[model samples]
Every structure is written in C-alpha cells, then in structure tokens.
Target: MLPNYLCYVNSVLVYRSGGTNRLTGLMLAAGTLALLLVGPSVIQYLPVMVVAALIFVLGIDLAKEALWDTIGRVSREEYITIVIIVFVMTGWDFVVGILAGIVFACLFFVLQASRGRNTIRAIFDGSIARSTVRRHITQRRFLEQVGTQTQILKLQGFLFFGTINSVEDLIRRALDIAAWQRNPIRFMIVDFSLVSGLDFSAAEAFTRLQRLLEAKDVVLVFCGLQPDSAVGIALRSVDLWADNGVRLEVFANLNEALEWSENEYLRGMYASGWASARAFGRAMTGAGESGIEAARTFSGASGSDMGAHKPSTGSGAIPGLEAAGLDIPDSKGRQPAFVLDSGFENSPRRSHLQQAVRMALERTGGDAMMVGALNSVPEIEPENASSSASDAEAGLEGSERERTERRTASSGEQLPPNALPQPGDGQHQSHNQTAIQQRKRKLVQPAPLLTLTFKAYAQEDLGQEFFANLAPYFTKVRISKGQKLWERGDESDGLYLIEKGILKARYDFPQEEFEINEAMLAGTIAGELSFLSGQVRNTAVHAELDCVLWKLDGTNLDRMQMERPARDFSTFFRMLLRVTEEEQECLMSYLVTRLS
Candidate 1:
C-alpha cells in the first residue's frame, strides 16, 4: 500500500512536468506499463549513480516550486502550512504529512469563510431604501416619519454557523432599541440576493431568528430566494417558508418584499390615524353619546363619502358637506349673520360650539388666520338681525337665502310663514321658483373647473387665478373601477390630473411578473413622464375606484401656449417639471437601494 501511494504521487509530479494535460498523463501511464514489463532486465544494465542524481534533481525542482516560489505569493499562514507539511515528510512519513496538509487546508478555509461581519453588506430603513411603489405625498411623508420601524439587512457571501450569529446579534440590538423607543420594529427583511450559499447550521440560525422575531411580534421577511437554489432549499428544509400567518413572508425580490412591508405600514397608519381623528372629533363635539356619532359621521363623510357628491361648478361649496347634513353655504355667498337669538342665550350648546371651534383651530396647527374666527363667536349680536332677514326676504339671492336658513337652523330659530315667498305675491313667487331651479341646475351640472382649494393643490399654493387659467386646458375623463387607462408601451397622448379616486401604476417585464409601482391618489399627476418626454409608457395604469380625472393633451397645451400669458403657461409647465423631478428622485432612490 505504501509503495502504491508513492507510485501515485510520483505519477502526479510527472504529470505536472507536462503542464497537467490529459494526453501527457496517458503517455506517462503507457511508459510506466512498458517499464514495469521489462524493469528486471533493464535495471541490471543501468548505473545506480544516474538514478540517484535524477531523483536529487527532481526533489530540488519540486522544493523550489513549492517552498521558494511561494514565499511572497501566498499568505503567511499558508506558507507556514507548506513548510510544516514539507518538514513532516522529511522527518516522519509522507502519508502523514499529506493528511496533515488536508486538515490545515480545511481549517483555514473554514476560518476565512466564517468571517461573518462581511456577510451583511448594508442596513437600511424605509426612508432611504423605499419600495418601488410610489404613493401620495402625504403617505410618503408618513413613511419617512416612521421609516425606522422597518429594518432591512442586505446579506452577501457564504453564510454558515459562524457568520449567521452576527446577523442575529444585529437584529437583536435593533429590536432592543425599538423597544426602548416604544416603537417596536414591525418587519425585519433579510435580503439574500447577493448570498452565494448557506449551510444547514446557518439555516438553523435563521430558525432561531424567526422564533425571536415572532416573540417580539415582528414579521420576518425573506427576499431574493430562487426556489431550486441551494440557499433556498436549506432555508425551506427548516420550515422557514411555512404557511405561518403574519409571522413569515417570502418574496421573489427585494422590491416586492419592500412593497409588502410598506403597504402594511400604511395600512396600520391609516387605521391608527382614523382612530385618532375620531377621538379628536368626539372631544370637540362635547356630546357624550352624540359625540361618537358626530365623530363617525365626520370621519366617514370626509373620507369615504367624499366622492359621493357631485363637484361644485363655480359655487365654491364643499360638495359633500350638505350631504353629510352640515348646512354650509357656497364660498361666493356672504357669511351667515349669526344673531344672538333668545334660545342661544345661556345655552349649554354654546360652550360645546366654542370648544369645537377651539379644537378645530388647534388641529389646524394653530394657524393665526383662525384666531379671529374663534374670538368673534361670542360677540354675535342681534342689532342688525331684523335688517338682514328683511334683505334676505326682499329678493336676496337664492344662495343668500340658503345661508340665512343654515344660520337660523344653528340658532334654533324658525322663520314666520310670511317670511317665505308668499303664494299670492307674483314677483316673489316667480323669483323663488327661479332660485330653486338654479340650485337644481348647479347640482346636476358637471363642474367646469378643478377646485384649487383641494389640499393637494393648495399645498402647491395654487389659487383661483391658476385654476381659471389652466382648468380650460383640461378635459374631464371619468373611468369606472377596474378600467384600464393605458397599457405598457402605449403611445403617450396626455397627462392626467386626478380630481377624485385612485389609480395604480404597474410595471410588467418579460423576465419578471407585474408589480404595482405606484398608487396615484386624488390631486396627484400621473403619466407625466411619458407625457412630457413623448416616450412610450413603461407602466400600465388602471383605476382602483370610480375615477374623475382632468386630462391635458398636447393639443390643449399648444393652444394654451399660443393664447394664454407666458407666466400662466410657465407656471403650469414648472408644476409638471416638479412632479417629474419628484418621481425621478424616488425612482433613483429605489434603484440605488436595490443595487447597493
């Protein structure tokens, strides 16, 4: 056995002289067979000195290549290993030395592979590395505010028992900080896109991580796992991809995983914000049982019911308020003269009204504009009440009459029957009839202009002047729920301004499945990229709910440039540019996060 091992080693060394080619190995085997067949007869004629000199030369050459040539080329540890193996072969046995070398090679490889610190490439939160899905400005701001709640750890290189501990320690420290801050981490995303492989021990470490995250009520999300890949198989073997509700989620890519986490964050925020808003409304109303009802009514009307009413046309009235049973007048009309009626004196409801007003002012972030409205509430006098009523009755406009009625309703007063248009009075009856018909017409007519006072537009400091000038360029387009607005690669025709409802933009590629890239909310601009640049659409847009949009096509834009003042056209163009800039920045951020 010893002789056979030596023979095998000699053949390998001879093969090395031929640059390790298969043909050279074959020739060496044939030569060795021939030499063995005739060895006894040939050896007697050969000079023993010649054999010794050839062996000496071979040893010298091998030593020069292994020991001398490797001095500065290999690591110090590896160089030392080579020296130890050579010393063992010289002092002890060659077989023992070869075994020791194998052991050392493995030990060093394990030590180098298990350096876990480099395994985690980076850590990010929602603020810096957001999902590809674009949301409304307000929703984006909210995500930024609570970005720390979602932690992402991007991992790379080989993962084993030694390296996984570092990842676990990092997550534990993050969890500890979150607990201390009273904002526990909601989702911990472990991205394995760059990971080359992971061992069973590393898989078990992830299992332990899962248990810890579950105990802390945090979700464990895994992304970038190919189903047939070794890492994925190892993780799956540990039941990490089990159908556990809320505890674990797996996605194909980081973007999908991020989008899922973000959606969860937003959903929670919406629920909590609604609860807070309801509580605020109840406190303001100051009617224990009725306060709850009022809160519910206010929240529902302001939120989901906003789209129920038709948009106002030049009325400046909040469309849904009347439907919500709040009898407020149009903005163009005069303010209701709130006279101090007999019923209002020393009324308990007055204090509640004051509290409501004060609370509203506070909620508005204590804007100075509302301070005057708060102070003047108690100073309402009845001195000019009779004159105002008389004026309202004597052919005052229909909107004025409506305002008076709303004011009287709040004051718990009723107008005398004679105060209403008398049946026998021809002029008053005709005028009253005309007013009623006009009110009906306003309700049925489609609003000719977008309301600049909408929170989204108001944020841009747009006012009536901007609305009046730009509104004419937009044509209203209504889309039903589930209707597709445009498909990917479609020619860019125009940009859309969302007046009401939600639209979602989805990206689809031949290599990947479709994913929703953005949610276009009311008052946001959509398709601006393709519209402005004249490029083919990259995403398909569809209505998430019944939608009302104002579309501005190239034709109208060209007309506006020709007919409108340069300032107006420039202002509108700047707004489009700003929207494009914001979208680009968001896209760039997502791409950077993904690549990094």
Candidate 2:
C-alpha cells in the first residue's frame, strides 16, 4: 500500500473499530494479510526519506490537535503548570512529571481555600435586624433588646486559619464601633448556618477570640453547628473552652443559641434590678406618697442638675434616672409590670430590657426615671370582656343548652354529623384538665413563644376564649398506639389539638431514612401549618400511645354557622376571624423563614 493510503486505512480502522461492524473488521483483516504478503516488494520500491517525512508530519498534526486550542483559554497558573510538566517530562520522565502536576494542583487548592473571599453576610442585632427565619424561639421584648446588645455575625462558606483571621478583624472593628457608640455589646453570636466546613485551625482561632472577648467581659456563642461538621469535631475534641471563665457555648442552631444568649443577658442584667424595684416599692409606703407617683416624679426629673447632690424632700427621688421615662406600675395593685404602649396596636411594644435597667438603676441608688416621650401610657382595653359576656348570656339560654345536650346525648361516643364537643362536655372533662396541666408546666419555663409560632399567633386571652367557644365544633378523635395520625404529603384536612397522651412527629426524605423530628405532648397542636396554608403535610405524626384529640375542620365549622344559634355562632365567627388573622401571620413567618 502507498504510505498515504496506509495512514488513511489506519485512521479509518481506529474510528470504525468502536462500532459493531463485522464487515469492516473482516475487510481490514484481509487487507492486512494482503499487505503482509506484498509488504517486502512494495517497501523495496519506497524511498526511506519519504517514510521519514510522513512520520514527521503526523507528529506535528497530533501536537497541534492536543495543545493549540487549550493555549488561549489557560490561566497564568495553568500555563506555569503546563510548562513545568513539559520540562519535567523531557528532562526526567513522564511518570515523574504527572506526579509533580498532581502535587501542584493540590497545593493550588489549599492556597485558594486559605485566601478565599469573605464569608460573612451580616453582623447585626436580632432586635432591629430581620433574619431569614422571621421567627425565633424566644419572644420576650427584653430578649429583643438583649438582641440589640448581642451581635450576630452570619457567616457563609468554609472556615480555615486565613478566613478566621479575617473574621477576627471584623469582630474587633465591630467591638470598637460599639464602644464609640456607647452601646457596648454583651454577646457575640457567631452564626455558621451557611458554612460548608470548619477546620481545627479555625476552631483554635475561635478559642483565641473567646479569650480576647473574655477580657472585655463579652460572651462568645457559636451557633448553627451540625454534629458532624468540621468545627463541631474540633470543639468536641477539646475541653479547653469549658474551663473556668471561658464562657463558650455551642448550639445546634442559630435560633437556639441566640435565645440562650438573650436569656443570659436578661437574667444577668436584671436579677438585682428586680429585687431593687420590689425594695423601692416597699420604701414608698414610708414616704407618704403612692409608689407609682413617686416613680413618675423621679423619672420626670430629667432636667434637674443630675451631677450635684440634692437634698431629699422624702419624694423618694432617684438621681439621673428620669431621662429614660421608665414606668412599671399599672392601675391594678399588682406587681409593677412594665408595659410599653406605642399606640401602634400591631407592634410588639415594650422593651423588658429597659424595665430591667430601671430596676438595676434603682438598686444602684440611681433615680429610676421615665422620659417625657414615654410618659403617656397607652390604654389597654380588656381583651375579651364583650366576648365573655356574650358567651355567658348564650350559656344561660335554656332552649339552646337543652338542644346542645340532646345533640350530645344522641351522638353518644360518635359526634353529631356537623357538631363538635363543647367545653362543658362531661366525657372530655378529665382529658381537657390533663392537657391544661401539661400546658401549665410548659409555661413555667416558657419556650420563647415565637411570635411567629402557634402560641404567638394565639393571643392568650383571645385564644382562651376562641378555643373554648370553638371547641364545640371539633370532633373527638381517638388514635391507637403506633397508629399514624397523619402522613407527610397528606391533604390539609384539619387541625389536631391533643387532649391526652403523646404523639410523635417524624420527617421522611427522598434519599434518607425517616428521622424523629419532635415529640408532641398533650396540648400541642399538630397540622397548624398545613391547616392554615392549605398545603400538604410536611411531616408525619403517629400516636406514641393511645391518644385523644380534638380535630377541627372547615366542614364542621361551616355546619355550625348554618345550624347553630345566632348568638353562639357570632361569637365563634369572631374567633374564626381572629384565628385566620393569626394564621396569616404564621404563614408570613413560614414564607420568610424559608426564603431566609
């Protein structure tokens, strides 16, 4: 075969061999056999210089095909790598060059990670700043103010020595600014919810940061750490942070840690102050003036010469406390409950931190004063007086009561088609009491009721009246042990309020096994999210034990509106409107939380 013809045959065979072409294979084999037979004679006629030229041209073609297209797009570092590999391969060996290239790539990766861009997205107080999750576990106004005194540094990406160094500078600058502004921070929250990883070196940097902050009497809290994350590993391995005076706490999530920090600030800042308020209240009886008036006068003395010592006219005046206008008394002869009435009904009005400060000042012999801007306390009307009266009037109606009793008796164990159990139901009395007790225990150390959560959505007084009046509309449900009360992705049929026994919520994911998300005790409401949003259930709930539940749905509610007495139905309708309003708030909270 001619040299060009042989080359063409070789390339064709290489390309076509990949397919299932038996004919091509046979032809190639026959051609090769023919070449073997005629090769010596043909080669004898061919010139050696021509063969050399063909080989040289083929090498050039291969080189251009491999390298030319890549040259322009390559980075400077890649250029250096290519040069090094070429030199090493030529001077030493291909194997050595490949190994060297691998090492260079690894080194580049480490260097890039060390010098990566800033991961911090924000640094602000939860009190003034909104988070992606609109709700927090804690809902105390004091906690909100404490949030202002705490700094949340939301970080993203990975944490390493170099990145941690950058973080240190950021924190130091924040501290300096706080000092200059005269609003020194008491807590520093390092939020790592968005972080991809954390190295040991970064953990060490945090230790150093803790030490630095400790000197300034600041507490450092690390939040949103997963159990298996790198920083979590480092922190778990060392107990140095737990040693005396370190004050380092790690939390499973940002919200939990922030709540803890807020609680700490609240307790620490106001413990003594509360004692002082009580003492001041006690001393007022001897001064011949009402305690509330004395406090107001002391608070209103802001323009007085605060620096100079003034004679006491038995007014129980506290010096320099009048500037802030802190009021703690109500018309009712109850313990001074600080209420901030901003006139905006929808807003969360009072700051408990301010009240704590007032108490703290009084303890330190500083005048507890109220500022002029805060002098006008907003009038808070009784929340449910009219509703209570209406309900009471309807209860006294003998005919309606007799009709409800007959409905209850006839239904016997199964509820009437459209009716629910009323609060006065004899059968549910014990279960309801048990649920109430469980709820009361939770109240002792109240979970920071997320203003965005169910508890927050239900105003205490309104919720009490609403559920009481509306309870008659919910059908009683009994679930057996291990039985599924509901499943994830099920339709939003109704809301279940547990009256007795325990239930558990679990989450099931596509690629992962089921996980136990939470345990529901009596009095907890399940399916609130789904019921409000008209969305499918996001979790599955199973009865941990035999459970008694009150299930409320639209069908039953509508039936009551048509068949029930007008007075009772009107009260329930008002409650339904309130519940809808609260659910809307919850839905907004849910949406914002997801986006954040």
Candidate 3:
C-alpha cells in the first residue's frame, strides 16, 4: 500500500510535466506487455545501474518538493505537520504517519474554530442597529431611549460542537452585564444569515441557551433561516420549544425579526405609560380623596363620569371607554354606542387617551404652553392657517391702530369735535363688518391634509406658503389594508408620500429564495428610487394598514414646472432631493453597520 501511494505521487508529477493524457497510461501498459512477452532477456539487455540512477533522481526530486519547497508556502503549523509526517514515515510505519497527520489536522481545526471572536461577525444593541421599519416619531424616540434591552448577535461561519461553547459563553457574559446594570436584556436576536452550516451538537447547545433565556424572561428570536436549510432542520430536531410553554420565534430575515422585537418592547413600555397616566388622572380628579367621594357619586349619577353618557359633541370624551371598563349609554340606555371624530376617527386608543388627558388638564387649569410638550391633543387650528381666528383679529386691530397713526402723521389733521362718530356711524360699521367677513373666510377654509405629511418630514417648518404651492401637484390617494399600491416591474409613474398608516415594501428574489421587507411610516416617501431614476419598480408596495397617501406623478411635476414660478418649482424639487439624500445616508449607515 505504501509503494502504491508513492507510485500515485509519481503519476501526479508526470501529469504536471506535460503528460496530461491517457497516452501516458497506454505507454506504461505497452511497456509492461513487452516485458511480459520478452521475459528476463529484454530486462538483462537494459543497464541496471542506469535504471537505479533514474530511480534515485526521482526520489530526491519528490523529497525536495515536499520538504523544502513547501516550507515558506504554508503556515508554521502546516509545515510542522508535514515535517512530522515525513520523519514518522521514514523512522516508523507509513500507516502510523498517515493516522498521526489526520489526528493533528482535526485538533488544529478544533482549536481554530473554538476561538471566541471568529464565530461572531458582529454584536449590536437596538440603539446602534435597528430594523428597516420606520415607526412613528414617539415610538422611534422611545425605542432609542431603551434600545439596550434588545441585543443582536450576527453569527457567521460553521457552528459545530467546539465553536458553540464560545457563542454560549458570550451570551452568558452579555446577560450577566445586563443584569448587573439593572437593565436586563428582553430580546436576544441571533442572526444566522452568514452562517453556512451547523452540527446537531451545536443545535443542542442552543436549546440549553433557550432555557437560560426563558428563565430570565427573555425572548430568543432566530432570523435569516430557511425552513428547508440544513441548519434550520438541525435546530428543529432539538427540543428548542420544550413543554415548558415558551415558543421559539423565527423570522425569514433579520429586519422582520428586529421589528417584531421592537414592537413587543414598545407595547410593554406604552402599556406601562398608560397605566401611570391613568393613575395620575384618577388622583387629579380626586377619585382617591374621601371628601370627594360624595361628589364622585353625585357626578356618577349625573352621567358626568367618563363614558357614562356619550357627549353630543366630539370634545371631552374619554378615549378607549371599553378598555377602561366603562360604557357609553345608548339612546335606549341599554347598549353602549359612541363615535369619535374631530380627525381622531382612526386614531389608536393611546392617541384617544392623550387627547382626553389634554382636555382634562385644560379644565384643571394646567399650563396651556406645556400642552404641546406633553403630546397633548393638537389645537384645532387649520393647517394652512398658522394661527386661529382670534390671532387674526388681534393682527387686524394692530393694523387698524397703525393706519390711524399714519393718517394723523401724513395729513397733519386734527379730529374735529363733530368727527367723533356715534355708534350708528355707517363708515365705521362697514369697516367692522368687512373685517369680520375676512376673519370668517380664514376660519372656514379647509386645510390641506398633505401639509401634515410635509411638516413631519421637514426639519423646520416650511410654512403655509410652501405647502400651498406644493399641494396642487399632489393628489390624495387612500388604500385599504392588504391592497397593493404597485407590483414589482411596474412602470415608475410616481412616488407616494405616506400621510397616515403604514406601507410595506417587499423585494423578492426568487433565485435567492429570500425576500427583503421594509415598512414605510407616515411622512416617508415610497418608490422614490424608481421615480427619480425612471426605472421599473424593484419592490412591490402594499398597504399594511388602511393608508392615506399623497401621490405626485411626473405629469403633475411637469405641470407644476410649466404653470408655477421657477423659484417655487425649484424649491419643491430641492426639498424632495434633500429628503431622498437624507434617506440614502441613513440606509448607507445601516448597511455599513451590518456589513462591518
């Protein structure tokens, strides 16, 4: 067997030296046949010393190639292995050397794989790494504040028995640190996108880790795994979801998993905030005071208690009456029935509570100036009008006073005693009536809804003038939940700005067997890439919730350019460009973080 292996090495050398065909094998066979036919006579005619010298030269060549030429070409460990194998083959048995080589290789591989840093590609907390989903401003702010509760471990390479221990230790250390800080981790996201494979032993290790996380009341979210993949199948074989009732959460991609974790975290936080607010409201309304017990009973009887009787008007109604264990009385006083309007028809229960709290504060003589800071109900002012009619009246009075002073200065005129008009003066009455009519017109005009979307995105207020000019170019569009705005490969007709609700864009790569999903919140623009590049859509967008969108097509933009002033159109175009640039920057930063 040892001689056969040496012969194989010599055949490889022959192939490297231009004998790369069946001709070499055929010639060798022919020589063997000739030797068999001619017997020992032909071999006796050949020079024995010459044959011996040829064999000696080939042996030296093979030895030099293996021992000296490979010295600088391979790593120190590999070179040492080679030397050891060569010495053992020379001094002992060839089989012993081969077995020794195999053992050393396995040991080296295990040592390299077990290194802690090599298994984890990157580690991120919620603050530095977030999902592609854009959320509301308040939700986004809250996530940033408590981002540390969610931890992400982006794992790479193969996971086997040796390497899995390092991953477990790293997670345990992170958990310990979090517990020490009094802000324990709530969600642990393990991203397996870059992982090539995993062994059954590694999968079992993860099951143990799951138990640890469950004991701590932490959720373990697995992402970037395909159900049909080997790693996924291996993981499924384990008792990941034991009879203890904790379910394992798995997502198709990292973005979706992260979004789910974030939503869960926010839901708990918001619920706690609501509970606190409810307690404060109860205290303020004197629900706990013994002296006010009778008053409370009387108010309850008079239907002044929240949700006791539906208010005829939209104002002063407590939001989420059912959630608060209260019911509004119907006309028959048997069933509960109520409706909320004043632009909060589709608002969440949180928004309703916020509005109710703001109204309560107003009635209790809370600071009006601090209302905006506390996420209070927005003042019922028109979007196009910066201030209310009362403000407009104040401005009119100031202008009238200035006019009187100007007339006195310019004409150098003094009012005669007869010039002092009585209450029935027609000129004064006409002027007063005209001013009142002007104020009424301002109050009655409906505001542009698209202005809300613009104000949310813009860093500073662009003012009513900008919105007034831009509004004409955009047409309002409403879509029901699950309705697709456009399919992939559709013509790039326009971009849609989300005014309300959520839009989800999914990019599917059939060949890759994975999809990238992103959520677009209100105030964000969708399909901007195709709109700007004049290309077909790469992603299909659908309404995740009932959505209100403002769309601007190329035709509308061109019309604006033709009909409006150059400066006005230019300003609008520049604003769009700025928003696109800002979004691109954010995406670039996110990609860098993930890739790094």
The prediction achieving the highest TM-score against the true structure is: 3
Q: After superposition, how far is residue 183 of candidate 1 from its true place, in Å?
A: 9.1
Q: Which 10-residue window in model 2 sums to the lowest lDDT?
A: 443-452
TM-score of each: 0.63, 0.48, 0.64
Report the number of the highest-lDDT candidate.
3
Better of 1 and 3 by TM-score: 3
Candidate 3, run of 10 with poorest lDDT: 368-377
Per-candidate local distance difference test: 0.59, 0.50, 0.60
> Mind giving the per-residue lDDT tens digits that candidate 3 earns over 169-214?
9888866854535555767889998999899899999999988887
> Can you tell me which runs of candidate 3 are displaced by over 4 Å?
1-26, 45-47, 116-118, 136-149, 176-186, 211-218, 226-229, 274-451, 456-474, 508-514, 532-536, 553-571, 585-596
lDDT of 2 by residue, 1-596 (tens): 22223465456445544735677678779978998987767667778997667655665554454356558787666766766776676678768888988988777766665554666766667564332111122223234444566777888887777677778877777668545255556668887778888778877778778788876656677777765766677765554345454567666665455435543443333222334333332221111111132222323322222222221233322332221111111111211111222342242112344554454433323311122112221111268545533332333233234566787788776666445445666765565556444332222111111111232223232332223344456676889988998888889898765544566676566747323244444434566667767799888888766776667787986787777778767754454455455334534432343235
Error of 2 at 32 (Å): 10
Regions more than 4 Å wrong, model 2: 1-68, 88-96, 118-159, 176-199, 223-230, 236-245, 258-596
lDDT string for model 1 (20-69, tens) is 77787678789779989877787788899976665666667667878899
